[model samples]
Target: MAAYHARSNSFPSRQHPLIPEFDEQLCRLRSSEAASSSSASLSGKLSGLQDLHDCVDKLLLLPLNQQALSNQKNEKWVDELLDGSLRLLDMCNTAKDALQQTKESTQELQSIIRRRRGGESSLSSELKKFLNSRKAVKKALHKAMESKCAFSLLNRDQEVVSMLREVQSITLSVFESMFFFISGPKSSSWSLVSKLMNSKTVSCEKVNESNEFASADAALNLLISHKMKNSDSTVEENAQKQLQELEMCIQDLEEGVESLYRRLIKIRVSLLNNLNH
Candidate 1:
């Protein structure tokens, strides 16, 4: 999709010339996401979003852009932009909570595994609890994704308003992917464990390994199942490895999401300032 609406000939040449570069960054993010699911892919996507928002912040700060957005006829689009910002904030917050919950649970499980003296009974009990926590997190993420807002088609001639809409569009798309990776890919018929198992090569894991969330879940489930069946101790080692990897992934995402949350707030504040001005 076109990342930003092209300005008409009548608009001044100096008015937000970053729009083209913004489009380039947006396209690069989408392409990178489609090509890989490595640890670096998620970080790259978040970094790309930060850059895109920086461009948007600059656009919002432009005098002509603010003036055009504040025009009486463009009030509806302005309200829509504000509303869109809120939706983005809500989704970002949901993602943060889910990641934090998963991180804590994963860490606890890892600690339990490390202390093999805790005995098989204790390990099994903690495994079940960890799986249960993951199930709840998945349900919450699914609900948030389901309840995400759809952008309304607003009729507006102003380039500034169109850029705002594009920002919302791209922001939502990136978050949807991040949430899917964090929560595992969507499936209607598959149960929590089954879905993650089956989704290894789906949207988020086509080219490479499953996302850390899904991979960790699958490994844990497999380890628990083997334990129930009196399997080898090797499985426990692998499961611990997966949990450690997942913890690292969560840390990177936690930092990235926090930064992006601040960026979203900045964007929203700029929009509100325009409305107030």
Candidate 2:
């Protein structure tokens, strides 16, 4: 009985030692798993922080790029506007100069017409002299026409006709240009005066057209003088109206440009506020 009791106690002591060692081994395994989990979490957190930093860097660069692009566009727009303004100024100056030149020409033409009216040469005597000279010229022309020298006569006649036509065209063009400047209703208040002058000239044309040949020539001369006088008066009125209209248009344009500039400035300010937010 004593030996059996001792054996039992020894068995208990050995089992107790094994239980402590097994418990220590289990603790070590649990600690290793916890350490591995912590390392994985730390790695994940570091990776996440790196991704956030990269995203932040990209986000910061995006606004800078947009700002740079916007600045370039604004500079280009400003340059274009400056160029356009200079061109407009040049055009305005040119128009002003043209207006002055037109005024001066109209004045000179009026003086010439007045001088022509004051002359008292009888139309009958002038017509008679002209007819006599024309008769001689006609005889000479007929002689040339009768000649067998075809090339020479043809060339001479063509040259004279061309010269006369050129002179007439040049005179007509000058008269038309003057009329446009002086009598234009779009530019000046003189349109009323011009219209009144036109009525008088048209009446003179009717009178000349109804007269007998000899008296008709005299009437035609008188009609021409009246027409020239009317034309000069018309031109002066038109030019003034045009100038006034141009000035008004310029004023409106300037106001519009200023409004646009103010609106653009406001838009830029708004954009800056949004970027800051």
Candidate 3:
């Protein structure tokens, strides 16, 4: 009986080392997974930051381009362009807000991970923070796009209209890309992926198509009006000279509009294909 008791006790003693060994192995595996997840989160955040930077760059350029074009146009166009400039500033502000929120979320996630004990999980807290940040980012992007599209539709300011159209198209494309990134197959979170992916593609395509048609129509109208004005001019030397200058300006505007249309079409096609695939 004493021998039996000794044997039974030795069995547990033999298994004692295995418990810590197994725990160590589990901890190592969990650590590896945590590290991978952390890396992925950081990479995603960096990509978002880069996108935000690009959007800001484009927003800055919008005002400068509008100013340059407005200088070459009528006073009405200048006022309109100035209004558009205010809208662009609004977009920049929204983007900055989103970026700020995302930065905070990232810092929070890092803090959670840092405070995690060995063999304890921090994934839930990290994912929660990330989702909150993503929601803010999406809201900001949506507001910016809506503001840009509205600005594009404003009448009597051809320069502002043109700049806003470009901004609208680019914003839609960027939003689609960001949506895909956040909801792609390899996304860390899977809860809302399907819903986001389903509706986004169709919405982007419609917006793009509508904007392209509007841009084309605006260009055509401008060209036709310029032609009509030139045709009604008297054959006086000064009138003829003015007509020629107007015609050249009209031609330049037409060419720029055509280029913009082609570029927008290309973007639309590419976005459609990407969405389909």
Question: How does each model score on lDDT?
Answer: 0.76, 0.31, 0.36
Compare candidates 2 and 3 on TM-score and give the better one: 3
lDDT of 3 by residue, 218-266 (tens): 2222222322232322212222232233233323333433333344344
lDDT of 2 by residue, 1-277 (tens): 0011122211223243433342343333323332322222322322332332232223223443234324543344323333333333333233333334433433443344345543534422432443343234334333332431211111122221222122222222222222232222231222333443456443333332211212222332332343455335443333333323333432433343333334333333433443344
- Considering only N, C-alpha and C atoms within 3 Å, which residue pairs clash in candidate 2? 182-235, 183-235, 184-238, 187-241, 187-242, 188-240, 188-241, 188-242, 190-237
Q: Write down the TM-score of every candidate.
A: 0.86, 0.23, 0.33
* Higher-ranked by lDDT: 1 or 2: 1
Tens-digit lDDT track of model 1 for 1-277: 5554556432335444676777788778667756656566778788889998998888677677788777787788899889999999999999899999999999989888888656877788898999889889889988998998799876546667776787788778878878778777643213434554454322223212466777777667766664234455555666787788889999999898899999999999988888887
Which is superior by lDDT, 1 or 3? 1
Model 1: clashing residue pairs? none
| Model 1, backbone clash pairs (residues 3+ apart or across chains), number | 0
Model 3, position 152, has a per-residue lDDT of 41
Positional deviation of residue 126's Cα in model 3 after best superposition, in angstroms? 4.5
lDDT of 3: 0.36
Better candidate number, 1 or 3, judged by TM-score: 1
